[model samples]
Target: MNVSQSADTVWNNPVGRLLTLLVGGGLVAGVLTIYPQLLPVVRWVVPVSLVFWGASRLYRYGVADSLSLAAGCLLMLGGFTYASYLLISMGELAGTVAQLVPVVGIFVEMFAAHYRNQG
Candidate 1:
């Protein structure tokens, strides 16, 4: 029940990773379709990369494990929400979708993992 074990459980399955990647990418793309500028390439790429890396490390190390993941996710969610807010404040109606993408992706990932385990 360790974090590394959990991650290995999550990652070793091709179906699970594919499911997550497809779902996550689609969600992110869908959100971007609205206010694409909300996720400026340079501005978000590095941060997103870092978050993913950090999440993986947190998962592997089990250093507060789920808490670490949750916190990272929440922090990113908050950032996305805030970015949307800023865009909205500037009179845009398409930014909130950015916040929805990863949120949905998280659920997708969880479901995929659960289903994989069940099988």
Candidate 2:
């Protein structure tokens, strides 16, 4: 194959998508680490974004084929609830997990979209 086609093929695959997610997550983490003050913004942004995304999907497609959208909302809610519980009763690990939940949800949604497009 030509160089352009080879590049497109690499980026269109699951592994490349995963790698992109990891790199994006890592960049966000690094930036947050550098500017700890942005934590509050991130906390709000994540949940709000999740809600908006879920709402948009529900509005556009309904639940029939958007299980992942519902799951993403649930993941966000569950993560935040658990994080809050942990913070009140335990510690920082919960906060870390809360941050990670949306990332995992995003990966799930991405794969779902990929497969849906294929099928």
TM-scores of the models, in the order given: 0.30, 0.46
List clashing residue pairs in candidate 1: none
Q: Model 1, 45-97: lDDT tens per residue?
A: 64465456446634653544454455455545645564555445533444556
Q: Against the true structure, what is every candidate's RMSD?
A: 13.8, 6.2
lDDT of 2 by residue, 1-119 (tens): 99889868878999987887899899999999999999888866656666566556556655677665665565556456544653566457866666667676677667767766887
CA deviation > 4 Å runs, candidate 2: 1-43, 75-90
Give the distance in Å from residue 29's predicted Cα in candidate 2 to where it truly belongs: 16
Best by lDDT: 2
**Consecutive 10-residue window with the lowest summed lDDT within model 1:** 85-94
lDDT of each prediction vs. the true structure? 0.59, 0.68
